[model samples]
Target chain A: MSYAALDLVMLGAAALIALVAVVFGRARVSWAAAGLALAVLLVATGVFDNLMIAVGLFHYAPHSVLGVAVGRAPLEDFAYPLATALMLPVVWEAVGRWQPADVRTVIASSRPISWVNTAYPFAAAYLLSTTNISVTFVVGTLFFLVPYNLLMYGINDVFDYESDLRNPRKGGVEGAVLPKRLHRPVILAATLSTLPGMLYLLAVGSWLSGLLLVLCVLGVLIYSTPPLRTKERPVADSITSSLHFVGPAIVGLALGDAAWTPQLLALLAAFFLWGYASHAFGAVQDVLADRAAGISSTATVWGARVTARIAIVAYALAGVAVLLSGWPGPLAAILVIPYLLVVAPHWNVTDERSPEANRGWKWFLWLNQLTGFGVTLLLIWWALGR
Target chain B: MPGVYLALLLITLGCMVILDWRYRLFFWRGPVRAAATLILGVVFLGVWDALGIGLGIFFRGDSPLLAGLTLAPEFPVEEVFFLVLLCYLTMNLYVAATRLLSRRGGVGGDGGNPS
Candidate 1:
């Protein structure tokens, strides 16, 4: 019933799923790539999670945790990255066995660089609200960290493979140009991979949390999948993408049984706006490629220059929204300036030159690291009473 | 002396501007674009501070280094200077880093030459 027990169950289930999918799915699993990915994820999760815990941003109840500490994180924490490392490549291999190519493409689609984007929000919200490491917290964090990303990006790679083929930005860290035959298996894998975590989460969470979780999954699904593909719907695309990142935090807060305080609402609003700006700005770079492939995105529909302007406005609004969170939250508004500065140079970038915005987009990636550090400091300050 | 923190921040901002001017570190090499970027950044951050003040998350710290002048309840005048400095510093660093990488011929579509 405790988090430690649930952690063990989920870990076993994830490993089992990965094993069965790889074995019976008739996929070629590269031990070297899988091993490297697992090592890297483990080290990253250990370092970042420990740093947050050390700063008193949150803490784990000793009994609920497995008492096996790697730095400050419990042994159960490794299960997330480990499960992801195991599951994704096998899924990729299973899905794309006809191609039988390098595992690098799968790694790229997994978006290791942005794993913390989903994981951090869930962990922070759940920990801040509950202040206890419960089954819900563990399940939510693990789910967001791995299965959530698998579903989000796997489906993206599958459906967007055609556009990605035309996009110079694909086949690397930004995205993966998955082969055509892998499409069905990838979708199946995404669904199957997420099922166990989803079931466990629903079992442990309330109706409110379940609803948020469903919305989160729906956002992931509709954003990339055809027929209901929201990513091609202009402004709605940005809104849905934002939901993909912010939904988990809402689910965390709800599952933690946190009150709907004005401060919490403001934080969520700010977070949502930030997500919108990030996706919009990201869309700017893909305007040319998306259009070439007959896709309709916020950037493609509105044109690159206008989308960039919208992004700036959204980022500014996000900063303002965060200010409503009060004292140190006001200090956090300064963090938005970096994003503004990065995007400002491309203020008038044309569709022909939108690809140039990739330079700023690259900085945006590193900027997230810096901004995350700044937010961590602000969180510590808030936790320590200004 | 109460404004020493603000003074240091201004000095740092000045240093970054001089460096940028001398090195053309950021793409907004022209004074007009740079000034525009800075102003926009300050305004957005200021609005954010105002909202935080309204929501009651930001309170002026009890540091003697603060100028002790209130822009609003729990809002200090020094924050403006601090934010300006933050915006300027980030711009300079981003441009400088990008320039350095591109100069080394390591820039790729994703920004860094991953290969």
Candidate 2:
């Protein structure tokens, strides 16, 4: 990574964390003091860095820098002090505010079970593409495994809590529920914890991958937040949810600089179709629940039967798309058969009888693990062949 | 010349200690909290430095004005001491400034009981 890029990421993350600490943690950072610190630190850096560099202590790779200089010190060298000035006080304040139960609550709200659903794609994509372990792979996978889910499901649960407060059927459903008191903490924790990993990934990635990462985060936000709660929109709901899973894979592929071939595109298209299909299928179980809650979804809008059929078509098309993936990719096509079978039994599922589809949704969950295992084998074969 | 860099850092750090003791500003005000914050800052900066080194954005200068001992490749022994001094200096400046600002009606106190 370029020194400037890394600096930018650190600078951006520090500034954002500082802002969030002020807004939510109510940390009162004295800007004037920070300024004084920065000014003094910068002068020290200018004097020492030049002296250090002039002594031949280290050198920079020719290809990895922008050639920008402040005397002998790279302009990028200043970010350490600048970032420190911005971030340390917030860390000081947060250290005082740390609580144990809040940690447990944040973890609970992240939906531990569903964490694998998002992490697998990113990890698999990066591992398969790069074929080597590096910091990006480890950090990105961990990010996807936890903080990413925390942001996705944590934010979702917070909104779910609000909706469930008015939900007469809340106690009827056994799932993670965000309590009212934990709202601000959840949002703060989710956003704050996501910063380091997200910023690092953004810095290391190409512009295209960075855009995809931003879209992935935006997908998480817009799906839950108001004015564009795509979660409540009819067809957009499944598309947004699909984006949630597929987005991470695309980001990983982009970061690993995977070649965008026809086979890869076809495979991704299949994955995309599978995602929306699974999402629409999952919506069937909640048709009655959502209708009761006055929430609009593909199932509530088109009734359970049409939604189920659309899912079957999406799965079948996903299989077709996978066939064009070449070599071992064709073997992965059979994996979608179980998905089709899961939704097939519910082909005639009606709005009044939608709750029964929850059984199939249960099958869908385990089927994912099985499918994941199958896909892993195929990916290994494909990677070895390459 | 062998320990010029390390000595400079220690002297600078001593100055910060004096400032803190004289003003009751950072470590003198709250030893535990100040120590924790300074440690956190050092760890944070250390990680950032490690990442930069891993990415090949940083290189160790083979300087003669330093101890030959190293903590890691390109990471000199002075680096840790430098980080400590940097963090301590920042805290002293922050606490002193916050005290001054609060006296002038700023929202944040100096993170201690009101004097």
Candidate 3:
């Protein structure tokens, strides 16, 4: 069987497990939130994946696909996000069953808005590197889309519960102020959910791919966990957070057995810089909250003004880095302009007023969608040239 | 005439520098940081371009205005000026835009420490 077929079966199984978990789990369900998440997933996947396929960024073998199309995307493409939308809340709700009082809080901590962030990188990288569908691609995509995020953000919610309670930004879309009672269960859930996927991936992946996957998981753990909480280390915090995103792509490249070309390296470097700048800028909004909680970060250490300036510099450098990736790639350099503009107004924000940067952070989220569209256009151009 | 593109690029960069100094946009505020970012940016982009050229994704398009000078096979001298202009212009635009917005009370208006 082709990778697409295997991917569909695994996704179906995952969705079923999540559904059963939600049905049995005692945690209260929010039909509204679930419906909203599903709707967003449908629209995003239907639109973006269809466009990517239509433009030929990558294509599935005719026999490998199910022959069903939603716009230009194969029907199978929707399964990844659909499974994610279902599995995340189900996992959260199931875990929350252990601490009934914190059920609502755990559900909110899934950070549904950012779910696509992890999934897209893995799916896009894998698809781009390997023109053909394979089981490794499917398995890797499923892992990153759901369990990887659960381990990354779920563990984060548990570990940061104390500081989250004090941060005004918590208890909402930014994060969930997970209660103390739910901490152990949340950690248990994250570990339990990720272990199966990790083992499956390690068995299927080459040694290089397995090592990169391990590093990716380790990045997620160390960024939030104690003693080695890299998030508490100013500049290192940005680098680690950046790795959390870049690692998945690296793993995809390794699994695809793609040759390391200079242009590819340049693109990865540019992506890394963009990720670092994003994390650093995001920290600016939490400067006061972090300092108040005795949590050190790039923003708290350098002060918000300096941190914002540095973020701008990093963004600019990212744009320059992209310029060397060749024709259509150079066009992506323009994408950074929007991001630079979004953070530009907060240039002089002091620590006391750093929270005001949240306004820009909000815009940053939407800017990501816009920038994603721009990148898609460039990808389409590159594909057309090929 | 072969070096016309390079010469024009340098002249445009010079104009940008003049404007930046007159407006105290970037370098005037933090010369050290600005210089460091510029140098790092140029070096990184240069290496990236060299790599791309080496990998054969990039090739210098022939033109009468081209410098006809080679940094390496398939790599052009004009690329250096282009990278410098890109970094210089982006930094200047970023700084000038921020200063303008701050003055307009669009950002950081509460004495830089608004609680």
lDDT of each: 0.71, 0.80, 0.70
Off by over 4 Å in 2: A1-9, A28-82, A92-98, A166-175, B1-57, B61-115
Model 2 lDDT at residue A255: 90
Q: TM-score of B chain for each model?
A: 0.82, 0.90, 0.86
lDDT, candidate 1, A1-386, per-residue tens: 44455555555665665666665566555555456556655676688658645544334445555578887777765665565555545543454343324334444566877788998889888887787775456657877886788789988888887777777877666767787766655555555546656866676578998998898899998888889899999899999999988898898888889899898799889989988999999989888888889999989988999999999999999999999985788888999999999998888889999999888889988988998889888877776783
- DockQ, every prediction: 0.01, 0.31, 0.01
TM-scores for all predictions: 0.59, 0.73, 0.58
User: Going through the candidates in order, what is the number of backbone clashes in each?
Assistant: 9, 2, 0
Strongest candidate by TM-score: 2
Which ranges in model 1 have alpha carbons more than 4 Å from their true place? A1-104, B1-115
Write down the worst ten-residue block by lDDT for model 1 chain B.
B106-115
Question: Which of the predicted structures, 2 or 3, would earn the higher TM-score when compared with the native?
Answer: 2
Give the C-alpha interface root-mean-square deviation per candidate: 16.4, 3.7, 17.3
lDDT rank, highest first?
A: 2, 1, 3
lDDT of 2 by residue, A75-121 (tens): 88888888778877765565445455655666777877778888999
In every candidate, what fraction of the native interface contacts is reproduced?
0.00, 0.49, 0.00
TM-score of 2: 0.73
DockQ of candidate 3, scored on C-alphas against the true complex (2 decimals): 0.01
